[model samples]
Target chain A: MLSFTFWDILSNLLLAARWTVLLSLIAFVCGGVVGLLVLLARVSRSAVLRKLSGYYIEAFQGTPLLMQLFLIFFGLPLVGIEVTAWLAAVLALTLFTSAFLAEIWRGCVEAVPRGQWEASESLGMTYFEQMRHVVLPQALRISIPPTVGFSVQVIKGTALTSIIGFVEVTRAGTMITNATFQPFLVYGLVALIYFVLCFPLSFYAKRLERRLHVAR
Target chain B: MAYSFDFSAVFDYSDVLLQGILMTVQLTAVGTVFGVGLGIVGAAVMTSRSRILRVIVSAYVELIRNTPFLVQLFFIFFGLPALGFRLSAWEAASLAMVINLGAYSTEIIRAGIEATPKGQIEAGLSLGMNRVQVFRHIIISPAMQRIWPALSSQIVIVMLGSAVCSQIAAEELTYAANFIQSRNFRAFESYFVTTILYLALAIALRFVLKMVGNHMFKRRSHA
Candidate 1:
């Protein structure tokens, strides 16, 4: 076993944490884009579109994220689509986050009181126009807390990317632990780093939830 | 570069996959039962009048909630063994699941308990019931009923989360897939089968839990 000081282990783990943050950003942003499209499809008037999006959501949500990561990382290469660990990790995380976020934002959009839609319709507004002007504006407010909350999940979920060999905080900790044979020290720091990353989001989510509740 | 799919390799290993499925189901079942019990206690403690107990429960909840389960599992599986507390992979996985599930269950059950009306508690007390009696008769039963859906969903999440046990070589369904893929180099077919099995298991678990809840809380059927 390598003799490592506290600072040595921490510095390595911190470097790895950058990947965690980056992966979370990539996944969250990409998932947000895809999820918005999914939300739109879900709420669209076309039955086929809605059903397809519904199926997509159920498929991702019903299955394990670990399984999804495995399928992308290992399974894709077999079919001639060569993917690096980074590609597979980001793709899996994005796909998983999109399903949940789409559901969340859909609930938000649906929660915009029925009368608001009726009012927009009365003004001869198109569905897109109504959503852009009347429905989404209100929905955005209600969506903030849960969206932030879901982002925390997204951040935590990025840890699973480690299994695909994307060297994030958790993966780095694993490596360090193996090298140093200090599982407690290494993993404790890992958990602490994750706590630092996640707690603020949890606090902010709670604050937003309270504000949203009071606003209503 | 086009490659043809060969699923027969995976099909031939169906028995191994079945074993993995059974283990996953067993892990989920044991974990959910114990986890919910811990959750109820945690929730009760958090909701109790004792200030220190509330703080302890809140701290436990926050700590577990903020950390990833993979890390938590590593702490148990890898960390504890180094501390001279060697547990098998199955024990480590189940313990981690119990801890994770307990935290989530605490939150859900606490919500349910809080939703219990003051009048009902008062009525129970006025009928000469002690605190424990009132708690069991009026609070916990109704709280379980009120939170059954959320609790069941959390349990399903636990079932899915069990996939992480493969990292520790727990030989669960995902681990079986990993093994088969490594052996056969048929990754797509292996994981595809695993995913279908997981979906089927999740659906089955939800159905069974729904029936169990229905039978257990018949008095609150309207709930």
Candidate 2:
């Protein structure tokens, strides 16, 4: 049996970490776009749109993300779409991220004070105009910390994609563990790598939150 | 593409689904009780005067918070055996859930504790209460009242996260889904049904938490 050195494991895991980073960026960006649209529908003028988006958020948020990924990984083939782990992971994470980010941003938008909305409306601005010129800008300011924080969740969420055979950090750790039979060391390193990636973001988010509080 | 949908294949294993759901519920219930208990202790340590303990708690919180739950679960399930602690899948899953939720609720509860007005603690102390008494009477109840909703939401999230326990063969709801799908080859229908069940379970769990929070915290407002 060939043995893996610690360097081999670490270097290999780092290589796979790049995919984790890439997958996270893709999901976050795509999810942000989709989330914005869902946010519009969620807070739209029409009751049907609002209710539909509400269910959309509920469905995504209420279920475990693993189940969602399972459905995407297993369900897509029946509909004749060629399924790769990449496609399934991206699709599932995007939908999951969109639902959550929309909900979080909705809270931020609602927190923008009723008077601001009223003032914008009294200026005879259309709903979209009010949203575009007034509400979104204010919401966007307070939304930054939470949005950045949610990206940590996005990164963590990508770990689940490893189960779907995506060759990211977690999958790499599993593969290396199989080869090295050092699950304790490999998994510990995996956890440490994630902590390294996520702690700075969490710390920054907290710092930003504090600054916002102090500013207000 | 026209594919005939067959949910009947999945329904044939209703007993397995029920067993899986029961296991999931059992895991969640244990995790919630002990996890929140651990969080309370962790938060207490966090808000305590001991610097070393506080640092330790903070480190624990950050470590668990930043890492994926899947990794934590895997580490406990797969790694601990090498360290001479051979745990069953159920034990590892529940332990991981407790630890995971403990870290999250530590931060959540600490936020509530920090928000407690200093004057109230002084007042409790002035009435001859010790630190533990102050924590129990003057601090914890009101803090819990304030953060009950957040804590409840965290509990529900942990419950949903318990789905990952299936990976280690803990036989949770998702495990049932996987089993049914494997047997019937109805992956879509099985997962679809299981996802809906999760949705329903989430809603029910939220309702239950709301009721419990109301019952527990009702006296706090009057006191």
Candidate 3:
């Protein structure tokens, strides 16, 4: 083990912080897209699509992300597919985020009110057209605060990617702590970095919620 | 490209797995009890008359809420030892769970408390109730009933988060699976079994909480 200095550890952690941000962005974007699909399926007229999406959400939400990561990273190789740590981390985090985002967005979509849906339907709009033109516009405004709040969860969930050897912030901190034998300083900095990354989103989420509430 | 999956190896470790499950249950129980108590106190402190106390409690809530549980676990488990306070993996894990859940529960319970209409407190005061009596009789019970669902959900989250303890070798279900997989080199089988066991435990815990909630709050049942 190399004897790492404080400066060396700080530099490594800062470098790894880039990966953390990148992973969060990738997971959040991918999850948001997939989650939108799942949300649409969940609220679709077809029972089959709704049930399938429900199972997808339940399976992802019920099982731990660590297990999902392990299954993707280690269990997949058994089936002749080679998955890198990045692929596994992104896949696991994306699936995890999708389940939660689907649920959050579903709540927002449903909060668009029955009257709007009725009005769109009375105008001879199809389900898709109704959601596209009428309901979703209102829901988007209501969804902002919760979506931002859930992003904090997405960012925090990325820490679990470190378990699969993805050298993100937590993993870097672990490596530095192992080398420097300074768990306190290393993990403290890690926690501080995570807080710095997450706190603004959290504060903005709260501010948005308050502003929205006042507007209502 | 054919490999036979031998689940027997995983099943043979049932006793070890059970022990880990019990430890998880124990950890969840202890953490929930203490964490909920801390949450109640923290919520009260946050709503207290003293601005300093409110600020301190708000800081604690925000700090814990914003940070990941794994990092917090590492901080307590590994970081505290460096500060001359050595804690066992179980102690550190439980403490971290308490801190995490307490912050969340404080927020949930605070919302419940705030939702208690001012008229109810005034009504209690008008009925010749002392401040303490009024708070206990008018605010706490009703607030608890209102927040029980959110509190129970947070408790389940605490239970799920107990798996993070395994990172420090707390010997929970996940840790047990890790040990079994390393010993038997049956990673897939071991984790499959572990996942199923966790699912069962989560279901059982949810049922139990629902039953307990039903039993504890009579008015809530009607609502």
Candidate 4:
């Protein structure tokens, strides 16, 4: 039996944390792209598209991320799509992040006054032009803090991927605990790592929010 | 090869699923009740004049908010036994939920509490109400009203997040789904049905929470 030292455990956990950070970044970036499209459809003139996107958001929001991961993990194989845990985790998390980001950005977009839309329209600008030039620019400004804030959620959301055997920080912690029988230490470190990852983002978001409030 | 669907195999264990659903509801109910109570105390302390206590409560809120609930659950369920404080899965799961929600609600309720106008407190004091009376009669209700929607959403999020309790074998809905899938080898169908059940539960929970919030704070706005 090879006895592991504390440094060995810490170093291994640190290595695993890289995957956590990578997954979060990938999900956030991919989710942002998909979420933007969903937001456009959600706010578009077509009631059908709006309704479809609305359901998409509601479905994702209303269910647990774990279930979504499980579905993708299992459901894909049925459709002849071979799915690894990494593929399933990334796919489920991307969709989950997209729904939430779409909803958050929708609120920002709506915060732009109706008159701004009308004024842009009166200036002979089309809907897309009005959005691109006027509404979106303003919405973008107000959307920054909350959008940054939601990245914390995206980071936390990646933790669920561990259950599907994606071998991230939490999963690594579990593996280390089984080896060392020091679950208390391992899990406490896991929580601490997540806190370190998330707190700066949340703190900065709060600071941004306050600055926005003061600006207003 | 095209795979065949067999949702009926999953349905064969309806009794287990029902029990799992009941346990999930029980966990949420316990979590919401005690969690919100703990949150109120935390909020009150946060709003109090004690600087050290405020710092401590804020630290608790920040720590819980930053960490994932699954990690917290694992800590309580797996970690505590090392310290001679053994907890059953159900016990650990519910305790984790309470602590998780308590942290969130503390933050939520504190925001509501902070938004109360100084004039309103002064008015309540001028009415010969003691500080406690003022808080009860003049401060808390309106504060709760303002943050109720946010609180309700947080509650729904917590409920959905509780699905992870199955990992510790707490026999929640997800655990039941896993059990059925393992037995029947109908992984897709099992998870699919379980996910739909969760969606329905989430929807129903939100509706009930909205109704409860309205009913609890109805007279405040009307008066």
Candidate chain B TM-scores, in order: 0.97, 0.98, 0.96, 0.98
Tens digit per residue, CA lDDT, model 3, A1-216: 457777888888999999999999999999999999999999899999999999898777666777788878878888888899999999888988888899888898888889898888999999889989998899899999999999999899889888889999999998888778899999999999999999999999999999999999
Q: Alpha-carbon error at A188 in model 2, in Å?
A: 0.7
How do all models score by TM-score?
0.97, 0.99, 0.97, 0.99
Ranking by TM-score: 4, 2, 1, 3
The collision pairs in model 3 are: none
- What interface root-mean-square deviation (Å) does model 3 yield? 1.1
Worst 10 residues of 1 chain A by lDDT: A73-82
How many clashing residue pairs, candidate 3?
0
Runs of candidate 2 with Cα error greater than 4 angstroms are none
Q: Write the per-residue lDDT of candidate 3 for residues B1-223, one digit (tens) a residue.
A: 7768899999898999999999999999988889888988888787669999999999999999988999999999999999899999988988888899889989998998898899988999999999878768788788888989879877876787787789998988899999999999999889888877877887788889888888888765575
Each model's DockQ score: 0.79, 0.89, 0.74, 0.91
Enumerate residue pairs that collide in model 1: none
Where model 1 places Cα greater than 4 Å from the true spot, the runs are: none
lDDT per residue for candidate 2 within A1-216, as digits (tens), equals 787889999999999999999999999999999999999999899999999999999999999999999999999899888799999999999999999999999999999999999999999999999999999999999999999999999999999999889999999999999888999999999999999999999999999999999999
lDDT of 4 by residue, B90-205 (tens): 99999999999999999999999999999999998998999999888877888889999999999999999999999999999999999999999999999999999999999999
Estimate how well candidate 3 is docked, as a DockQ score.
Answer: 0.74
Chain A TM-scores in order: 0.98, 0.98, 0.96, 0.99
Summarize candidate 2's per-residue lDDT along B69-102 as a digit string, tens digits.
9999999988999999999999999999999999
Off by over 4 Å in 3: A1-5, B219-223
CAPRI classification of candidate 1? medium
